[model samples]
Target chain A: MTQEAYRNRVKAAAPKSPLGKNIVMAFLFGGGICTVGQAFLNWYLSMGLPQKSASSYTSMTMVFLGALLTALHVYDRLAKHGGAGTLVPITGFANAVASPAMEFRAEGVVLGMSAKMFIIAGPVIVCGTLASIFCGLCYFVVR
Target chain B: MQTLFIKTPVTVEAHAAVVGKKEGEGPLRDCFDLVAEDIFFGENTFEKAESKFVSQAINLTLKKAGLKPDAIDLLFGGDLLNQCIGTSYGIRSFEIPFLGLYGACSTMAESLALASVTLSCGQISRAIAVTSSHYYSAERQYRFPIEYGGQRPPTAQWTVSGSGAVLLKNGGRGVRVTSVTIGKMLDFGITDANNMGPAMAPAFVDTLKTHLKDTHRKVSDYDLILSGDLGSFGMEMARELAKDEGIFLGENYADCGCLMFDLKRQDVHAGGSGCGCSATVFCGAILPELESGKYRRVLLISTGALMSPTAIQQGESICGIAHAVCFEGE
Candidate 1:
């Protein structure tokens, strides 16, 4: 078959997703995850932590919860339903690191899991650190 | 089109199926030879566990056929692993002349076709065709880890964590391997790794058309026209494509993947897939039906998507292939 004809056929036969429905799902599920984080932050504040510390502790809790859910095989279900909502959070980072580590764990702890654990998240971490350093340098120069 | 039929018939003397605990709980639970309580089968990793399935399947089939390792002239098998290491590592200790094959999920059909051809030539008296696939092992190799908690789309198929083997001889009293139609690779330019059913449907229909044309057979000729592991969506697409070619598959068509698991209860969205998808089903469900004279003549077409993580990463389209083997019994 000709490439052009084949491409046209595939386009016709392939199923299309509803963008409107997907956006609504993303908003609901994404908002749901953030609401849980907010509740955690409130709980930490009520337990005597300062506002800033409570916010930091909430992030930590969310990351821990993400990794735990990933380990329990629950987060994939959330991400599947919520799409980018689950992906655009600290929890996504936790899943990113935990996923590869668990996969490579069969290879061993030191070389397999430990070395390849940061494969997906390493770039984000490196870039985030470098961007913060650049911001700090800009502040110093302005001062 | 050239005839893909064998001149002399090959015989499937015996067969064996070894599945995981999850498969044991499925609809065909009682059909398998042994269902390992542990998915690992006493292996350290899921990879090794998969290898163990291949070895045990071969051993069990050989035993059922009442033959020793030396009685078999050749061992042809493969798996969904890189380099087909699962097949190699499993059959290594047996000292059999091994031909490691890779047709992805279509490997079992590929092996059977080659084995039958070799036997019909009168050179090899006996050959063993086997293939295996493991869920966790394939996931880690092709996708992310099971721990990733990634939600599977409805089109995604659950890879069967099992192994199946058939001992084929020159002539026997069991199911007769009448002929095999080798498949051609067809690329539809589909790039999505998750949706393989649509990508493979065209190739499957192409093979079915050619097989019918070459053999002068119709959809009604066989008791069943079985596709390997096209799952639910792919099977539907194949039927639609076949209908377009003026070949109505109708009630005679079924997919091993679709029949292997209960879609609703088992949580297998698109149905069971993988090399074991067809292999275990053939040895477990189909072969038994043939033996009981339920399906006198059946055409088994195993379909495969020939794409790797590297190829998909390089933005290459997935190509699909389907190999057909005719099994007849009195």
Candidate 2:
């Protein structure tokens, strides 16, 4: 068969990811993570912290939890079932950075762990920074 | 011209299979010679662990055959690691003449075919063919880090962490290598690295058809026709492709990948893959069945996708090749 024909055949035969199930799981898990962050914020607020300080502390707490779960090898299991739910949050970013670091740790500290720590998260940081700069320039000009 | 009929007997004297924890929990658990609970196999790194598996399999095979490493005329081996380090490092202590192979997942059959041909040519009296693959090693090299929380598609296959070895001699009371058909590299423009079944099915079909045509035998002539590491989807594709070419692969046809694990309980998605998938299944299950006179004739076609990470990144379609070996029982 022609390559085009074969490609079509393969496309037809390949099994697709369960979109509905994934969406539901993502919603539940993502919402659950957000709920936890809100709870942390509330607890910190009730402890007499300001709103801005409370939010920053909550973000830091979530990142620490993400990194800890990844180290314990639980985050990947959660992500397997949670899909985008675990991936769209700050915790997910922590996992994205920490997983590669743990994986390449056997190669050593500097070249292995630290260098590869940002392999997955590097692109995100670069694009996010660039986009923010662009938006900042636009805001400055309009203001 | 692709198929060669062995005039001199090339018999399988002994064989061994070593698998990791997950595969030990599989349906063929009882068939493996050694099922290591630790995937590390007592090594520091996964790569070293894979090498340990290869060596263990060879040692076990040698012990079973009651032959010293020096008695073996040649050793043919390979693995999925870069530069075939798994085979080289694993077999280094044996001090035997070695020729390494790199047929991707098809290394088992490629080595077997080459060993058989070399033995049949009367150049070697005793030879061993072995191949292995490790799940973690393969994953880190091919896909992502083990701890990476990325969801794999349903079409993805679990690489089998295992090794299989077989000893072949000029004459013996064991399974005989009757014929071999080397396949041509064929690309169907498949680009999805996750869906390897379809990427390799065409090559399996081509090699199977060529072997059948060359031997002038029908598919039913053999007691079993097994494809190496095609998994579920690829096996189905092979059946469909073979049907299109007027060849009906009946109930006797199966895939090593599908047989290597429990599809429902194992969560292996499509099924087990890698060089070890077919290698372990063939050594652990099929060889014993053939030895016990349960099967008279069997055909093994190990298919491989020959795309590297660089090639895939460059938007090059994956090309596949398969090697077919025919084994018969006395």
Candidate 3:
């Protein structure tokens, strides 16, 4: 079958997911994640930590939570129901790394788990670092 | 030339199936030989767990027939994983002469066809055909990370975590493998990996058409006609295609993937799709019904989408194949 014909038939036959429902669920779930981070930030502030330190601690805690959830296989369920909500946070990065490591663990330590850990998140890290470097250079030139 | 049916008949002496927790809770719970809640199955990794499933299935199947691994002349098996490692690693401990096959989700039928043909030709006294699929392992290899919180489209199917093995003897009181129709590669140029049912439906129709022609049989000749892993969407599409060919597949037609799980409750959008989908259903559910003489003649057509991550990445369209195995019960 030609690509056009297949695509037409597939589009007609594919199941239709409710976009409005998914959007609402995503909003609620994403907001819930952000609210949890806010709570962590507030808790750290109440303990007299500096704002900078508190923010960093909040991110660290969320990342840890993400990794833990992935290990326990709970994040997958959340992702299924929550959709982009689970992915639009620092937790998603942790999951992206941890999931590959867990999957490739069978291939042995060096080549499997360790090497492929960055398969998903490697591009994010490289681009993030590069953009930051470019901004830093711009700041120096302006100064 | 690619589509043909078996001539001489072979016998299925014994068969066994092992499934994961989720599958065990489904409608066909009693059909499975072993159902464990844990995906690990007392192993460290999901890969190991899958391998154990295959190994245990083979052993139990042999034991059910009162035969040892040494009694089997050859073992034919495969899995959804790359390199067909789930099958290779699983059967390695038994030290049986192995020939690994890869037909993605259609592996069960592929292996069964080969084993039946080999036995029918009198080349082997006994042969074992086995295949397995694990949800976790298949997910990581085919899609995103297990924890990636992306919403799957309704077309996507749940990969079943299960294994099935069948022991075929030269002759037995069990179901007789009457014929097999081997499929040719048919590419519908489907690119979406998530919707495999639509991609594979054409292949199923193609093989079914050829099988009917070669065997000089009509759809009504068989008591039941089954398809592997077409799920709900593909199953419907196949019927539509068959109707266009002036052959209507009525209620007797069922897709194993659609029957493997409860779609609404299981959250499997289209249905179940994996190597184990048809494998488990055939060994666990279908074979027993045949033994009970509830059905005299049955046709099993297993469909598979042949695509790799590399192939998809290279922008290649997904191709499909289906193998049809006909069985007659005494």
DockQ top scorer: 2
- Candidate 3, B1-330: lDDT as tens digits: 544444555788899999999999888999999996698999988888899889989989988989878899999999999898899999997888899999999899999999988888877789999999999889988987676657889888999999999998886566898888899888888888988888899889999999999888899999999999998888888998788888899989999988889989988888998998899999999999999999899999988999998999999989999999998998
For lDDT, candidate 1 versus 3, the one ahead is 3
lDDT of 3 at B227: 95
lDDT of 1 by residue, B41-113 (tens): 8988898999999999999998997888999999999999998988899999999998999998889989999
Best by TM-score: 2
Return the lDDT, model 1, position B40.
Answer: 80
What would you estimate as the lDDT of candidate 3? 0.89
- Record all residue pairs in model 2 with backbone atoms less than 3 Å apart, i.e. clashing: none
List DockQ, one per candidate, in order: 0.49, 0.82, 0.60
Q: Cα miss at A94, model 2 (Å)?
A: 0.9
Position A28, candidate 2: lDDT: 97
Candidate 2 error regions (>4 Å): none
Best by lDDT: 2
lDDT by residue (B254-308, candidate 2, tens digit) is 9998998999899899999999988999999999999999999999999898988
Window of ten residues with lowest summed lDDT in model 3 chain B: B1-10
Q: Model 3 clash pairs? A: none
TM-score: model 1 vs. ground truth: 0.91
> In terms of docking quality, how is candidate 1 classified?
acceptable
What's the TM-score of chain B for every model shown? 0.98, 0.99, 0.98
User: Tens digit of lDDT per residue, candidate 1, span A2-78?
Assistant: 65675566567655555677788889888998999989998998899999999999999999999998888788888
